[model samples]
Target: MKSDMAQEEDEPSGAVLDQPQEISFRRALLDRISPLISSTYTLRPFPSKWQVIRHKLEQLRSYLAAAGDSPSDSQLMELLQSVTYTAAEAQALASRCADESYTGGKLLLRSNLDVVSAKLDFHLKRLEEFYAAGILTLARAIVVSRPPAGASREDMRFYVKDLVSRVKIGDSQLRLRALGALNEALLEDEKYARILSMEVANGVASLVTLLESESRDVQEEAARAVDSVARFDSHKAALVTAGAVAPLIRLLEKPGTSMEAKERAARALKKLTENSDNAWSVSAHGGVPTLLSICSEESGTSELVHAACGVLRSLSGVEEIKRYMVEKGAVVVFVKLAGAREEAAQVQGIELLLRVACDDEQSTAVREGVLRALVRVLDTGSPKAKEMALRAIENLCAASPSVAMLDHLVVSGFLDRALLLLRGGEVCVQEAVLKAVSRLGGMSEVVKKAMGDSGFIPELVRLLEVRSLQVREMAAETLAGMISVHKNRKRFVKEEENLNRLLRLLNPEEKSATKKFLVAALVILTDSTSVRRRIAASGYINHLEKLAETDVTDAKKVIKKLSSANRFRSLLTGIWNS
Candidate 1:
């Protein structure tokens, strides 16, 4: 009775005569149809293809999860294979959809594909607007995974040439994508960048046009691409000649631009201004005032401030631009940035101010404020920052009016930090520190005393043996300056090692300037009875007498002083008799 009832039910439903067989037939039909749905479904227009394909993938994932034991391993592999192929196709379509000439069919089919490609680009941008993070991630992953190894020089040139052409005529969305691709390729490898810069004709001109795009993404990406290409000195003049300066200045001046965009534009301007002609072009396009405005923008970001300061630092090398920057309150902005928490801004700001202070006309205007800012940087900034700070200090101290500011530097621990740097800082930092010390030590008694109290004498003495001739010369000159003060002379003469180092530098092979300072320092040290006796006993008088025969007036004077010193008269006569 049960078998008859089951057969009745199955016969009504299908050819199967049993429930299990009926279920098996339905599963087989589903397995065969799943691939078709996953592969050939193009129901939606190109604009909505991504969404339709995404939905198809999600359905496939769900069907795989629900399959349990119904579908064979082969069927599962086939379904997954279709999903993989479709995903690859979707990615390829997204990238190529922006290509207006991409046609995948015969005459009629080609027309249809072109229309679909245009629609796809339009809708892809819209989709990106809604799901920007996801799309960007996918795009970045695709771009990063594809290395530029297979891209020959000609291929890169053509690629950039095509993109530049598209950038001119394509929609805003396409232009942005093309510019973005250009930027990516430029950044990926220096070879591609060099090829684009040297081989492609309109690459830079198109980037300049993209810099003026209303889209900030296009503007920022274009500026960054310009920055990368400008790294090659060969391309700098080309970039500047392509009208990059005017738009870059405009982007920097535009209030509505993002800080990142302004930052990139400022960096590009900095690079462009590396050529003097480009600097003149920038000034002609009102770049200095715009950069000054950015420097003074209180709400500007650290990156923006840093980039602006860098541009100003470069432009300030031009005397005319420098005077303009100073007249426009560049000093005030630099003072503020030098004290900011941003290390890069602090470094660049100090560097720009240093340039300004190097000019005789502008040095007085920023001397006091620059001194204070440099002290702050030397206290808490990085090694590079410290080096810049010390250089600025040296420049500021070069002005006669800034002499009184030495006490402020000393009170702020400038002497202490400088001494520490001389001992263990980087080579650049050490050189800067030595310069600052030498300049300040020559200016005032208070600075000399502070330096002496900081144990700088020993450090200076040790520097006499340093490998750099400049360092050795600076050390000797500083010592001569210190001993000019009577109190410092007493202190220096009391240190046996200091006197020994000074005498050692009197070797005939030593530099003439070094020998002159050494002689001057020894002249003061010999004012002490004990130092006079020590020098007479050491027989350095013979070397000093030989040096006196030359044009070294100080050496001649020292010989007379040593011969006349009552404490050394008998020892000197005994040596002369021998």
Candidate 2:
């Protein structure tokens, strides 16, 4: 009877205590956030992860009871969050969020007021919706709240680090986004100087190690993230010391990765050693010789060549690096890329060779040798390479004037080969040869006549109607050069419609090179007094003046040069004498 009476007495008070009041879940969780955010700020006695989860469950049960038999809408949401994060790092989270002032007597937490106060829909149904999508707001919630000194050697740091590691690589986009966030937070100059942490370095190393992952995006992000982390000298040295260069170079050999990734890595490598031992290490790792082999491949990979050239370009700038490049067969590589059929490869290859060749004898040999090869390449390569090679030759000629290069190619019958191929070759190669011939400085009238005799005008005219911008540029340039020489100059003006077709491309519809070519061709029409009279008589000069007024062709230079007494006398003096 006494036990029953005591139980009856306790039941009344228990019922009153169990009759939950309406406490908001946000108020409870947000109130605790300061301690949570600050919890990992210092090393602490970490509870077992399960203990943290169990403590959080107890807190949720009590908080839910206080709100009512069930939680208020806000309290319910906090309870669900507790479930997600308690198993993650509950006590450390609370401690990280808590203020230093709280240790004396209070348990107040520092909330990321921005996150806490933001009105979020945390209903179970909405939470589940986000959870199903793997976008639990709490997971995103922890990102911004992280202390700027994000990684440390403490146990909580290890635990949090493990959490990130446990995040599956299956979600590439999310993983990349997470990497961005981590880089933004942990990769800081201050972090490097004062924080006394290699944790960031470890994180970066993990990212760089992913370069070998079969996943292209992972390799890309890994390279990008590695580039970002290499801002510090020590980290850069560590990465180089750790043999990261070879793997990055190997990734460049992968044909599938984006050019952006390859270039980014190339640039990073250049920056890392800043002309130190890493440049030579690239070769020691078989990087240079491998790059040389890649350059020799003619499979039409423009982007890959550009990327490979970028690595070479950087290596060519410093004396020590340049020497390393030379020793590693860079000369042979550039010589080959200069002769490649891909436009970008030829363009960048020439640019790369120009840099390497601009200074010393060895460099000059590579540059001149490549130039000689390109002269022949202009005859034999695909239309794209021929055009690109011509442009590159213009640049190369400015850097290293070598007519012997062209003379040799000519002696080898390269001009005839190019012209022969033009008539039967793809309109591209035909056009390329024409543009190339325009720039082929040391040419004889016999060669020019051979080109004109190859039925080049009709084919060029046919190509003028072709839609390719580069093709038209090449055709226009070829016709211009053909008209500049005495033997073929008359052939151009005799084709009445040729003037009209060249004029259209000479208009605003054309590219700059096309206009230059048209202007060159137009200047031929007024070469002599009789030709000028015929031009003046046939309305061709007036048409040119109108075109001069059109301004698209920059023909004023040609008109001004042609009409001047000096220019007229100089021109009608012989070449345009017809």
Candidate 3:
């Protein structure tokens, strides 16, 4: 951090701080005025004003220590010179006031004292501004350098500290370079991110302030660094505490800001809002509308749209913000995003749609549009995308089971797509499909029968044998909904294996929570005499007897129904034998 002041003494006055000779001259001037202000001859005449001026001069002398080595801005050196000469003038005037042979009048002397005091006060304030801008600290800051390869933690710590300081006070080019290096260091490892965010003073704040830099390069680099730091969960709280949200939203809102900068800002915001408090911070800063606008812009790059929608998706977790997003036409944005060619954008949009679809019912066109996009996702998207799309469809139809919407779902082949997904999709996708089936199936008997006829019942029945208890429970729940339609009940009862599986699940030894829904499905079937006769004859009736004794959810009622059917069967057999 050595200063670069030159030895040349002949440079112009504008470049005086660069010349060691001028620094020495400024020092000598301060020294000569020091004794004049220190003496009682001056202080006794104007005690209060002299005290103030002397203190200001002392502060000015402190600046000389750094100014002697550092190449301060020209303005700073000029002010220093002005104050030093003013202090000398104040000393001469005080001397005139002190001496009885002085020719100047008393009022004139008092006025001179007032003028000098005002000048010192004004100079002190300007010096304070310089310090506040970190000019003095910048002067003393170590020279910026790249960290050595395989640097030790201590070495890295020093490097990161220097970078943060430079970012806080460096010139435009220096700040840009420092920010670029800082961004690289942060991304290279979380350790540097930790040091910058928690250990280095004002480190996060420095990055945040640069979000508003006049230089587009500086803004971009700062955003990159903030985005990197924000990716680590441990650093997010510090960023929010440092007020990163508002500037981030401003960057997104700023017109004609380069997409590169906006993308990084949006990404940092996405990470920040993962924490609920940070989401509220963004919402409080009016970030939701900004995010929605980004999502709505058709010309936005896929990555940009994906990142912006990602922010809104995170924000949707908050109930209050979720409603607010709905009011602001986030649904329209989400539906548009859901149709994007990019898989990531579609996933983000669908995820948010799943959260808020139930609250949005005014736009049937939007719902259908979202439904069509979801179907497209189911058809071509990756497994995760398919899962999110299924959930969104489930929520959309469940929220508003209008005949038209349900008809749209059916007419658009939602059931067919779901059936295919259930057959071959990943376990997660299948699970989401089961939920969708349960919701949509319960909405319409036509949908239920359509699902039953499409072999959904068979797939659900087979899912009962799968290992995930949740899947089995959802399967049973969906089947229970399907069987409420008389045709579905008959279709389910026609499979003796389905009945046997249900009977096997009823075993008290089976601890699956699916038993309740299985029991409910069986109760729906017991209305049929043949189905009851088949269940009574099954070997797994022992499980039913145990469940009946425990009165496990409609178990006794199932037994009573089976008992009545048994009596009828015996009478029929006896009559036939006679």
The model with the greatest TM-score is 3
lDDT of 2 by residue, 439-506 (tens): 66335455556667656676677766666778777777667667767767667667766666665554
Sequence-dependent TM-score of model 3: 0.65
TM-scores of the models, in the given order?
0.57, 0.46, 0.65
Ranking by lDDT: 3, 1, 2
Tell how far residue 54 is off in model 3, in angstroms: 17
Error of 3 at 79 (Å): 3.8
**By the TM-score metric, which is better: model 2 or model 3?**
3
The models' CA-based lDDT, in order, is: 0.66, 0.54, 0.77
TM-score of 2: 0.46
Distance from true location, Cα of 510 in model 1, Å: 13
lDDT (10s digit) by residue, model 3, range 241-348: 999999999999999678999999999998988877788888999998998998888777887887887788788888888888888988778777776777788788
TM-score attained by model 1: 0.57
Candidate 1, residue 241: the lDDT equals 71
Q: Model 3, stretches more than 4 Å misplaced?
A: 1-18, 25-78, 81-121, 124-171, 177-214, 224-260, 268-303, 311-333, 340-343, 504-508, 567-578
- Tell me the lDDT of model 2 at 469: 76
